[model samples]
Target: MNKIHYLMNREVNYTLSKCFLTRLTGWEEVPLVKTDACGLVLFRFNNDFTGLRFKLVLNDIEILTAAHIHLGMRGENGQVVAFLFGPVTRGISVNRGVVTGIIVESDLTGPLQGMSLLELARKMEIGNSYVNAHTENHPNGEIRGQIKRF
Candidate 1:
């Protein structure tokens, strides 16, 4: 292929491979909490899929403590594979806000320990992963949503 054609194809592939989105709700949490708390998370994978940039926005949540990407199917609680917000020393009061971060191989834990970020991406692509947010009132998890391609 010509240089221009190759570059065009590369750009298209990069955009197509990059995004995943999820909508979090208290109802999705295991044991189902009764709260209006909800949120959305967006994951943008790098071109090589070796890492990702994530943005999480929460609404009506209180005393937010932590957020993470867990490895599991919907309606199941799973081990944390990556942290998006603090497993903070203390909960931070929040009504609505955003958390942003980048995750790479080194940031992985639990079942993903020592694995490449691509492994995580593969699991997420298959709907075997989720994003969960925790609060002081629900330390186990206040809200959650399964990750899926955008």
Candidate 2:
């Protein structure tokens, strides 16, 4: 919908590196196979909440196993929106979101000199799940989860 801005607590970086991220898709039930495949994306808001910031967690990750962005509400079968590598997280703003971004601990990148966690977390709404992987054909992801703040 609209866009908002907020800062991260510095803990988000740590949380991502330790968890698996998955996006839910389809209006009906479907199963993903490789939960631990590869090609995890590190997501965040733009420094000014205007755009999205994204990077590959693993530099060696050259393939996309299987990924889909959850669009509908939770528990609902989300559409299978295939994604390669870009600045968007399941169509959600990465650096400039109205809500939050998801990440994997092993794939979580630190808040470097150019990243702003606050502006990114402001408009977070983890309504749907974002499923991801590192291989091209690997249906099941090596890890997946919806980012959360505690």
Candidate 3:
């Protein structure tokens, strides 16, 4: 039997530590960091048995995708927020059928589109968020996730 886990009433955040190229049906991690860079933020909303994620890019721009999603974005003020929503599935399907009912927001804007995270990784000199702009860059960062058991 499929154990029905209820994510229908929770909201969580996943901090993406690495850039990735995603398909409509699966995920592929991308190595987009060579030096220090700020990671993006993923806001997930569980609604009526569906999983939704959200994020923001430069200029307060936003983007949305399904749970089985992939994205690479430009960090804003040191972070990006992406919005996504759809059925939540675990494991993997050897072959996924055609994708349907993908819910994209009306206000959705392409922030990472045509942008290269790899290039950003090369040009940006990651440094302390709390440090002065003239300080030396630190080529290191971290991401953390916390979950609460109901």
Candidate with maximal TM-score: 1
Better of 1 and 2 by TM-score: 1
Sort order, lDDT high to low: 1, 2, 3
Highest lDDT scorer: 1
lDDT of 2 by residue, 35-103 (tens): 322334445543333334444343223343334333344334444332434432232212222223333
Number of the candidate with higher lDDT, 2 or 3: 2
Q: Tens digits of per-residue lDDT for model 1 on 57-82? A: 99988888899999999989899999
What residue pairs clash in candidate 1, if any at all? none
Over 6-121, each residue of candidate 3 has an lDDT whose tens digit, in order, gives: 23212211222222211111011121223221223233333321333334121111121222222223232222222232322321121212222222333223443344332222
Cα RMSD for candidates in order: 4.6, 12.4, 18.3
TM-score of each: 0.87, 0.36, 0.20
| lDDT at 132, model 2 | 42
lDDT of each: 0.89, 0.34, 0.23
In angstroms, give how far residue 80 of model 3 lies from its true place: 18
Give lDDT: candidate 3, residue 102: 24
- What TM-score would you give candidate 1 relative to the actual structure? 0.87
